[model samples]
Target: MSSKELTDKLVAAIKSGKYDAIICNYPNGDMVGHTGVYEAAVKACEAVDECIGRVVEAIKEVDGQLLITADHGNAEMMIDPETGGVHTAHTSLPVPLIYVGNKAISLKEGGKLSDLAPTMLALSDLDIPADMSGQVLYS
Candidate 1:
């Protein structure tokens, strides 16, 4: 589905007030970036940006939190420095991990993906399992 459609569903779900946590992935950035079209990539980012605004509003309505993150920054660079063509592969760049909520959360800097689960559990007021591979992202 398009990012707009996906975000619409996400907003609806958030408004339902039936969930303690929600995870969303907008494939537009990575999937469309693979096409190696700069204009398409820009449009993809814009689409995701718009969707994110809607999501933030939904989260506000429900008094929930948002954690926006990604595994790779595929759309960050679209030009190949050597070949003069579009960069179509994922990069080694650090991905973003943004948190939004009313809670005064103090997130640790330089957190890795493994920190996500523990952070989520801590945010939910649940104990981080002893077997969890990472430490909670609170400083």
Candidate 2:
């Protein structure tokens, strides 16, 4: 879908007031970056930024929480040159985790992906199951 359409739908959902939180992955940075199109990647990042801004606005209207993160990093920082039409394997570089909400959580530098689930659960006032390996980031 076009950016405008996507934005409209997101705004509509936010206004619906059915959910308490918003979890979104603006895939442009990851997808466009994989093709080695630097310009397109930049544009995609801009688009994602705009989408994020809109989402944040919606969240603000309801005094709700917004969790913005990525499962992995494929854009912004390219560690190596693309070769012969083949993109490089995923980097060991850490992904970003940003939380904007009422709950308090402190994320230390070099945190691992495993820490996310527990942190989120804690934020929602939910218990982290004993079987989970991650600790609550703040608690």
Candidate 3:
């Protein structure tokens, strides 16, 4: 879906309050980055950022919190240092975990994707399942 559509849905969901939580993933960056088209990739990233800004505003209106993260790094590193060409492979680099709103969680560096679930549960005061190996990212 387009970033605008994603933003509209998320804003509606947040405003509706029908669900306790929601996860909105913007695929533009990742989808466009794969083509190695620099301009398109940049635009895709910008679109995602714009959507994020809108979503943040919507969530704030509801006094809700937000957790922003990515499954992996892509458009963030668009060029290769050696060949000076577009880098298409996914990087091993860590993705940022941004917490927004009044219920912001304290972040610890060196966190992995696995840490997200436990951290979300902890933030919501929900019990972390024993079978899950991931630990909370915050103190």
Candidate 4:
């Protein structure tokens, strides 16, 4: 399904108050970025941005915490300035780690992608395993 559809369902789920946790991944940026078409990537970002506001509102209604982060960077450097060619692969650049909520969650610095797991667990009020390598991003 498209990002809109997925987001709509998520909003409904959030409003329903049926679950303690909800997780969503919009594949538009990553999937479209893989095509190495800058124009398409722009549209993809616009679409994701449009959907995010609705999500933020729903999260506020439920007084829930939201952690928004991408697995990797793509479409940001679609055109390789050095090679003057289309870059179709993921970039090594750091991805954004955004937290949205009424209650503050202090984001820890030096957090890696692995930190997402621990962060989610913390948000859900679940215990973190001792062997887990990822650090909790919020305290």
Candidate 5:
């Protein structure tokens, strides 16, 4: 779907009030960036930024929290100087994570991807599963 269509759908979903939280990973950045279309990849990133802005507004309307993160680096990044191209394989590079809302859900120092599940569960007053590798990040 076009970016406009996707954004519209996301806005509608947020306004529906059927869900308490939102989690999404738009594939445009990864897919377009992998194709080596630098211009298209940049456009995709811009689209995602606009869409996310709208989502955040909706979340604010409902007094909800948002945890935005990625599993690994794909877009919003550049080719490693050593590699000279987008790394065809995953690396240990740190990904970006943004927490928006109350201070209660803020991350403690040195949080990692593993901390996400536990933090979400804790925010909802749910017990963290024993098997989960993440620990609740206390701010």
Candidate 6:
């Protein structure tokens, strides 16, 4: 589905006041990015940016928190510096881990995806399971 359709649905769902947590993925950034078309990838990124702005506004309106992150890095390294050609491979760069509306939270260095679960549970005032190996980033 297009990013617009997905974004619209996400906004609607957030405004409905029914869900405690929601996950929205915008695959265009990676999917179009992998095609090695620079212009199309730029447009795809712009669309995702607009969608994220909309979602952030919706979350703030409902006094809800937002945890924004990515599974991996794709568009960050678009072109080879030496070759000057389109590079189509995921990078080892660290993906962003943003926490909106949660001023008490602060991420330390060496954070991994496994830490997300514990951090999320802590943010919601829930207990982290003993078996979970991730450390909570915030109280």
Best candidate (score: TM-score) = 3
Tens digit per residue, CA lDDT, model 6, 18-105: 9988877899878977888888889999999999999999989998998888878888778977899988877678888888884666
Give per-residue CA lDDT, model 4, range 52-138, as digits (tens). 999999998988888888888897889988999998898889887889987566777767888899888887779999999998887
Clashes of each: 0, 0, 0, 0, 0, 0
Of the candidates shown, which would achieve the greatest lDDT relative to the real structure? 4
TM-scores vs. true structure, each candidate: 0.93, 0.81, 0.94, 0.92, 0.82, 0.91
Tens-place lDDT per residue, model 1, 36-131, is 899999999998999999999989888888898897888988998899887999877888778888888777778788899998888888998899
Count of clashing pairs, candidate 2: 0
lDDT of each: 0.87, 0.71, 0.85, 0.88, 0.74, 0.85
Better lDDT candidate (1, 5): 1
Candidate rank order under lDDT: 4, 1, 3, 6, 5, 2
lDDT value, candidate 5, whole model: 0.74
Predicted structure 4, TM vs. truth: 0.92
lDDT of 3: 0.85
Q: Candidates 4 and 5: which is better by lDDT?
A: 4
Error of 5 at 120 (Å): 1.0
Whole-model alpha-carbon lDDT for candidate 4: 0.88
In angstroms, how far off is 130's CA in candidate 6? 1.0
Off by over 4 Å in 1: none
Q: Model 5: runs farther than 4 Å from truth?
A: 83-91
lDDT of 3 at 118: 90
Question: Which digits, one per residue and each the tens of the lDDT, describe model 2 over residues 18-131?
Answer: 766555556687787677676787798888888888877877787777667777777665436544444434555677766666665566666676887887777777888999
RMSD each, Å: 1.3, 2.8, 1.2, 1.4, 2.3, 1.6
What candidate 6 gets wrong by more than 4 Å, as runs, is none
